[model samples]
Target: MTPLDSSWLAARPLPQPDGDIDKNSRGRVLVAGGSETVPAALRLTGEAAFRAGAGKVQLATVERAALALGLTMPEAATFPLPANDAGELGAAAGSVLAGYLDRCDTLVLGPGMGAEAAATAILSAVIGEPRKGLSLVIDAAALGACADMPNAVRAHEGRVVLTPHPGEMAQLMQRDKSRPEDDPEALACEAAERFGATVLLKGAQTWIACPNQPVLRFAGGGPGLATGGSGDVLAGIIGGLLSRGTPPRTAAAWGVWLHGEAGRRCAEQIGQLGFLGRELLPHIPRLMASQR
Candidate 1:
């Protein structure tokens, strides 16, 4: 396949600032993921959502992480799920989650959720159901959870966006191969067509592809973003955009752009080596404001 060209970049338009009174019209976003090992994922995603313009951000996590997240970011609401002896979300947690799915405009799954069986079950339930009005963004562990559940993506009634690194894409494609560093765009487009959803394949040049839309490459982000938790931050931004009534392709395209811009801003200040995901939080609003 020929490498995806750069022409798709011009297709997306920057978001216009809402009138002062209409600013509150921004949507609600729910971030579900967090386990004993990686409790910070939920907080990272929730904060990023708020920064990206979600009017409200809620997080669903295991009991232990809930207290810390709630205390740390009092702006975000928390829903604690029942965990088994292993400290993982149990299958019953899905029933609890289903009740809140209706309240959120978008659902962002699998930030820091570990690979425990109970967590897998909860993710499976969330993806299996038909979420009619909600948009879903599957990232990190959630992408891995769906490796054998390609049909789950097909069955979902809502808009779905998948953000994965090359390794994760390999697993999703069920292929034991490495990403052709030469053409990340082509690989992402193939995966998006196969999965029937918008695909954001992350790398030096993040590439986004949707079933009907042309492949888009965002070349703005820098190496500063290669750190951990950055992907969760990107996922949260996408969730926020989806909540704001942006189409899946538009949200993915803009989210990737904003994320890279944020990383670039951070690199300018922190010299690229020590910039943390949390640091990128403050830059989101500035970046969005610049779009105007």
Candidate 2:
């Protein structure tokens, strides 16, 4: 296994945008799915994408939350998706989001989105679209759908990445949640091969497994990163990297390092624990710049 550390990152650095590059050239990330229950999910995600150097971001969520989310985060263009009476984005949201696939470089799905069926429907719709060059970073409730729709994910081939903690991993593999994962790397590799996508199995020491490649482990980021909304930030960072034209495996590896290192920095300045996930945002750009 390769250790994803500062030295490893320095040797294989991220691509730098040209000085004359425009926002469109840097790429656009469409972050879909949020709910009133987790109002900060989309904001934390969208802002982290910008911090990671995505040129633009668009937030698409249920209509009830769109205007307020837009007002709070003016940097992103917000789209009000169709919502059910219960306020969750439903299956119909798929068609609306499908229309935007052509223009999006990466789609970050299932951040704070509480409805599994809705996310699955949207994922199916998005995958069914015939667009090319768009990648995906699937997280949270969406991971369950991904497990059910392996064929849909394979349709995207190498352009997909799944970020799941142990619990989500259990759901993806249909393993008993109460049973301990004796070998996390084995489980990650199994999932990666089964889904034909890069799997970033999150933990104190993250294991990133891509089909046909050796597992890469990132052992930093500290326990502080276990805070709520932290996974959303990591998803956005990977989305931003993919939007910038980095391949899925590389993006997952680099994003894990960036997220972990930012958490480490947060621990130093704000203490090892109790640092909010939002506090990790500002550190991303500084960390990326230092890499250059």
Candidate 3:
């Protein structure tokens, strides 16, 4: 396993900023996941995408929460999608989102999405269609959706990244979640090969695996990053990097480092465990810049 640290990150440089470029040049990120129960999930993801230097970020969520989510985040362009009485997105969401996919450089799927039929439907609609320029960051409920659609995920090949915790990873790999993972890196690699995509298996020590490549590991960030919405931030960071046209494996690796370091910094500033996920955002750009 390769160590995912500052030295490794420095060697794999990110796209440098161009003074003459506009927002469109940096890249656009579309975050499509949210419900009434977890409406603010999109805010954390979208804002983190922006913090990671994505020029533009948009939020597509259930109709009920769109207006208020928009009010909280004026930076994102919001789209209200059809949803059920419980505020989960409806099947039509994926179809509606298809219209917006081409406009975004990357799509961050499934954050704060609760268990619902819409999750599978949306995943099917999005993966069923081919959007060449659009990369995917699959997380949360969408990770579960991926299990039922492995071939669909493989259809995207190298353009997709899966961000799942051990429980979610177990689901994707069809492992018994009740049992402990014997080897996290091995499991991550198996999932990566199975799905034909980069897999970041999140834990206290994160592991990133890509098909036919060396696995990378990061054991920093401490318990502070174990909080809610933390994975959403990491997913957004990866999505933002993918928007900048970084390769799936490279983006996943860099994002893990940035996220861990940001968590470390937040722990230093706001105590090790109480720091909010949003608190990790401001440190991203600075971390990237420091890598330069």
Largest TM-score belongs to which candidate? Answer: 3
Q: Tens-digit lDDT track for model 3 on 1-292? A: 9999888888889887778998988999999999988998999999989988899999999989999999999999999989986789988888998888888999999998988738888988888975788899999988888897888898886799999898898888878994326789888888888889999999888999999999999999899889999998999999999999888899999999999999999988889889999999999999988988
List residue ranges in candidate 1 displaced over 4 A.
Answer: 1-25, 117-119, 180-183
Q: Model 3: which residue pairs collide?
A: none
Better lDDT candidate (1, 2)? 2
Would you list the rank order by TM-score, best first? 3, 2, 1
Give the Å shift of residue 57 in candidate 1.
Answer: 0.7
Question: lDDT, candidate 1, residue 206?
Answer: 77
Worst 10 residues of 3 by lDDT: 173-182
Better of 2 and 3 by lDDT: 3
TM-score per prediction, in order, is 0.90, 0.97, 0.97
- Report every candidate's CA lDDT: 0.79, 0.88, 0.90
Residue 149 in candidate 3, Cα distance off native in Å: 1.2
lDDT of 1: 0.79
Kindly report which residue stretches of model 3 are placed more than 4 angstroms away from their true locations once superposed. Answer: 178-180
Model 1, position 26, has a per-residue lDDT of 72
Total clashing pairs in model 2: 0
